[model samples]
Target: MYKEFMQWALSSDDSWAGLILRLTLGLVLFPHVAQKLFGWFNGPGLRGEMQYMTTKAGLPVWLAVAAITVECVGAFLLLTGTGTRFAAAGIFCLFIGMILVVHAPNGFFMNWFGKVPSGAEGFEYHLLVLGICIVIMIQGGGKYAIDKLLQ
Candidate 1:
């Protein structure tokens, strides 16, 4: 069972697709992670983000913390093609939650042209992230991945 599990998790038959997906997801998510963790991109820093997510966003403190950690750590993992599946799964769940809890209420279209009242963006971006994550989970980390080295 352990051997089978390792085989499934570490296998990387297709390289380019996973490479593209992993890089894309990592690049896109890294900025958001930086925003929350370091206040880069004019985002709230860790303390501020925690407060806003828990108070305004109504997310539990633990969940908010987990989200922040996952985004930051997962980005690095995906970028290096190490633990890509786990990172993808983490990001997948995070985007899905964001869609359900935050973006869905805003409707399908993004806040393009600053038209939305709440100024919150829509779920389209989250859906795209989710799709990428799904592809990563299915395809593994491809060539250049640490998983390949393990194999």
Candidate 2:
């Protein structure tokens, strides 16, 4: 059972498409993870994010923590091309939650020019993330991936 599970988890086909998706998505997510985890890029950081999610967003502590952890850890996994499908799925779910909880109320299109003044931005970015997640989930990790090496 363990062997089969490992085989399934670590198996991946070598393809440039997968590699491109993994690397691009991973790099894109990395800054957000750093911002959330270390307060880089003037982000709120973990503690501040937790407070905001709980108080302003009404998310549970556990959920907020989980979101942060997934973004941080999953970005590494994606960057390393290890468990690409699972990481993509996790990111997909995270985007869904964020869209439903936060971005939906803002309507389509990002503020872009501070047109909304104080209103939140739209879910356009979330849709892009979701699309990328779907692509990665379908393709898995390709060349240079630990999964491919193990396979």
Candidate 3:
């Protein structure tokens, strides 16, 4: 069972589609991770993010920490094409939580034009990311991925 699971985890094809999806997801998420963890790109740093997550978002400290950790580790894994499924799954759960907790009330469209009265963004971005993650999970890391080495 362990062997089978590991095989499934490490499995990937040589298609460029998987490679493109993983890389795109990783690159897009990295900046957000950097903002939350390191305060880059005008993002709230760890302290600010924690406060928001716990106080405003109402997430427990541990869950908030886990989410941040997942984003950080998942982005790295996605970028390197290592443990692609695991990384994609982690990110997938995180986005689902975001949509449920925050973006659901904002509706489907993003606040691109500041037209919404609430000024809060919608779940479209989260949906897109989730879709990408799902693809990566199904396809695995493609060409040049370290997962290929493991397999």
TM-score of each: 0.94, 0.92, 0.96
Worst 10 residues of 2 by lDDT: 5-14
Of 2 and 3, the candidate ahead on lDDT is: 3
lDDT of each: 0.88, 0.87, 0.94
Best by TM-score: 3
TM-score computed on alpha carbons, candidate 2: 0.92
lDDT of 1: 0.88
Reference-based lDDT, residue 85, model 2: 82
1 versus 2: better TM-score goes to: 1
Off by over 4 Å in 1: none
Candidate 1 colliding pairs = none
lDDT of 3 at 145: 90
Model 2, span 9-35: residue lDDT tens:
677778888898888988999989887
The residue-by-residue lDDT of candidate 1 on 1-151, one tens digit each, is: 9998877877776679899889988998888888888899998889999998899889998999898888999999999988888889999999888888888888888988997777888888888899999999899987799877876
Query: Where does candidate 1 have its weakest 10-residue lDDT segment?
Result: 6-15
* Candidate 3 global TM-score: 0.96
lDDT, model 1, position 107: 84
* Residue 47 C-alpha lDDT in model 3: 98
